[model samples]
Target: MIAEVMGAICVLIGIPFFLTGTLGLLRLPDIYTRLHALTKADNVGLGFIILGLAIQSGSWLEVARLFLIWFLVLLASATSCHLIAQAAFEKNIKPWTKEE
Candidate 1:
């Protein structure tokens, strides 16, 4: 019962972050800001999705696959974000700071 409830909650939680990423990607002013939004959404979305999947799965193999997928998402997101950030830095994109 608890696992079922938690699974529902986790799945619901994942949706918002995914939506946020989509909206931010569409609405953010520039590349760097968009990237920031992307990272936040991607990480949280993946986390929640994995958590939900883990909670819902009955078999060990299924859970392990979810874990593997989570691990790959983390690895890929980190590497890709790092490269994007590096490129932004090299291009001298000014971060949206509050100093203005």
Candidate 2:
């Protein structure tokens, strides 16, 4: 019961952040900031969903695949985001400024 509830909770929490990441891609200014949101929150949301699914499945193969997918997501997202950020930095793109 508790596991099921936790899985459900994880799904609920993850989906919103996933959506927010997508929305943030549209809402944020600058490619670097957008990349940060797209990579970080999106990867975290994916990890959460994968973790929830693994917990619910409770099968050896399923757990293995879930972990693999999560790691792949982390690796891919991090690499891509790093590339984007580096390119932006090299191009002399400005970071966001506060209103003070």
The top-ranked prediction according to TM-score is: 2
For residue 22, model 1's alpha carbon misses the true position, in angstroms, by 1.4
TM-score for each prediction? Answer: 0.83, 0.85
Give a tens-digit lDDT track for model 2, residues 10-67.
8777898899888999999878778878987888888788878877887899999889
**Tens digit of per-residue lDDT, candidate 1, span 10-44:** 98999999899889999987777888788879789
Model 1 spans > 4 angstroms off: 96-99
**What's model 2's lDDT at 29?**
84
Per-prediction tally of clashes: 0, 0
In model 2, which runs have C-alpha deviations exceeding 4 angstroms? none
What lDDT does each candidate get? 0.87, 0.85
lDDT of 1 at 8: 88
- Name the lDDT of candidate 2: 0.85
Query: Residue 70 of candidate 1: its Cα lDDT?
Result: 85
